[model samples]
Target: MAVSLLCCDWLKEYKTRHRVGIQIRGTVESISKRFFTEVPCVGQVLGDSFAEIKSLGMPEHFCEDELLFILNTDKRKSLTLKYYARKILYFLRQQNILRSLKTFLEQPEEQQSALEGAVLVDQYCNPLADVTLEGISVQLDEMVEKVKKTLRLKNPSHPSLRCAQGFFSSKAMSIPISLSVLYMTLSHKLGLHLEPVNFPNHFLLRWCQRPRGEGNEKSYQLLRDSLDLYLTINPDNVQYLLLQARLYFHLGIWPEKVLDILQHIQALDPSQHGAVGYLVQHTLEHIQHKKHPVTPDEKRRSAPEHVEVQYSVGLIMKHKRSGYNCVIYGWDPKCTMSQEWITTMRVQQLSKGANQPFYNVLVQDGTCRYAAQENLEPHSAPLEIGHPEVGRYFSEFVETHYVANEELEMRYPEDTRETLGKVHELYHGLSLDSGHQDQASNQPNHTTNM
Candidate 1:
């Protein structure tokens, strides 16, 4: 197809340019430093990553910057996330994967920079195993075309496409925020010096076009002015603002902080009063359960004295009775829900009853369940749970388990290490079994001795 040819040509040109040792833009070090210093929200999202970024100061590909960012932010020690990150970059360097960003790249460089400003949220929301840069580009292009068609139909006189509104209204159809992050990365490959702007309710990128030979202060001022003007002209809707606050909560920002924002929105628009109250109540419950959790020790006695918590966080478990896949994000020493709900679910029917440990799980069916320990089992062949809330509590999906994110770690600090140990032990046991079978097969028949 013509699209494939375009992809090949674009990749060839990009690789040729890369091989020439042309420093199109400054190293990722400088870019990351500038982003950290100028963009306070970025620093907030990725806490204390300055030291990590400083260590990786050498000039490298744009993808390396994102990989490092994801690794640092997630704080995942598992090799699975690293392996997949390396795999993506390897294919990029080897030109094994097609560059499907040809159309976006071919657009006017100015417009490309604008697109970067509109979709910089991708930095925090990194790509997953199923998310590919090429796939995102194709989707982004299709969305743009759709938006352009709508604009032409609605207002033919002024058909200037709005990047933020279009992409915001049109869902990515893949992993939630994959397209946004990949869009920023794809533009970075084109040598655009786009800096992330801390726009209200969203992350925006601004093209940093410094006076040919000037210091950062001047460019910073220009960016500030542009951001100010942009804000003044384009205001966010109340509904969008509420959604953004919810998004911040989902991304593991402080519950009190998000709640404050929601309350403020409610104050500004009385229409959202009821919705904000419900969200406030929901967030308060989340804070009580996760942020200031009562450890198993505090609940009854030390974990040794009371019922030993069988399952740790970040475990992929199958419901023995319900027959559905789920991943654990939290657990209580015993059932902590209301007695009414317990009676309704018939918790008394279980062998251990409501006294057994209960797990808070994100189910594949997009529902949250508090399953009893007796009803859960380790998945025989664990795969990633396709749940929308996976990003809220966990960061990386290891081979058979999920790696808890910082917020989840705050609640269950020991779980991440335990999950890693369990994974290693599982593989070690498998290898031992294989070795025994190999030895048995290698032994020759001693017919002469017999």
Candidate 2:
């Protein structure tokens, strides 16, 4: 109860000073730019993102400035690779959903900006439909207190069932932090005076003094400088570095800093050198699977002559050869079938049968099969694809079209691209200069951080 009051009061005072939380609204770039400038160390988050990628053996030198290229470029595709670069770019980008969050917080109306951030990942974009600002404040305060009581918080990814089910995975829990910087981004945006503390193995968010502006600024810079120094003096902070390295590995992302940290750990304790070093190397190769690429999915394809003819996943169509209604859910660029079928379709063109794309579909009665691209047509009849599971997999089942799930993840069999992965739901197409496109899209466009 006391915490809840404090939460409410703190918010009230913050809103009183700002008059409106206008700062919360903006495109992710705009918000991040402001956030990095205003909040501490957040500017380096783009570079730090590679820190997670680096552990998986991804190069620590992944480009930082190309983020805007993705924001500005048109969607390009490669029929040969069956890959969409824009989708990967979009998968990694985030919009500041803070405008919605700000309104949800009941902050007074101020000038609105772009409305986007990195913290607003693909999932958890929307708040529970009926929740209110004050209601969420009370709940957040309670949860924060609960977390404080246990003080056993762990990094995300391999989170304990309690934290996952209780806080992040549960829509009822009010907020989620897919990344630590996300929580810090939003907390500081809300004037919470929160700071990221490098607690031994994991990270923690703690309150810092706000009244002492100059002192706080000095101390914050000093703290940041010390971290830079420690990371530079690699041997001194091996354990802390190891904790971060392993943390990203568990989260299915790489942590390159792990290399620096690992070298020191192995050198200081050679007994661990062989085992730990080998395992880290194995994980890196596994994550960056160049050895077994199913396709050159990185290739981009502009609107080739028949790009529109290529049915998107979740598109309803009719199998011309079989004369059956079906929905297109996947595509296979090459066929990998057993001898029995190879014997049956001996005359089938190798381009379609052996080494070109075939449409993977769900038939009317609900079984999956691959049909040649030439043997399919856009369903012209006014019949609904009533496969019972259609509703389960698609966003909408309109008579004329199948609305794809907004968070639909693109996966291929070999798990190569799936390792490094692509961008999630392409909420905004290259038409991205207009962020309204995202809000207007069918995806649940709610926003909250930590």
User: What do the candidate models score in CA lDDT, each in turn?
Assistant: 0.57, 0.42
Name the lDDT value of residue 405 in candidate 1.
Answer: 59
Off by over 4 Å in 2: 1-272, 279-310, 317-352, 360-399, 402-450
Cα lDDT over the full model 1: 0.57
TM-score of each: 0.40, 0.26
**Tens digit of per-residue lDDT, candidate 2, span 33-70:** 22211112211223233222233342211221233333
In model 1, residue pairs whose N, Cα or C atoms come closer than 3 Å (at least 3 residues apart or on different chains), thus clashing, are 117-205, 122-181
Q: In model 1, which regions exceed 4 Å deviation?
A: 1-302, 424-427, 447-450
Displacement of the residue 366 alpha carbon in candidate 1, Å: 3.0
- 1-450, model 1: which lDDT tens digit per residue? 988886687776566545322231223223332221121121123212222333444344444555545445443443234433333343233221112233334567646643342332231122233454456668978987887898789987662554454444223355524555776788899987666665545555656553232112233323333332332234345655676566555544346657767877877798888878888888788766653444332222235634567778888889999898999978888798899999998999999999988988878766677899999988877788865446556667767888875545755777777777766666657778999999988999666854
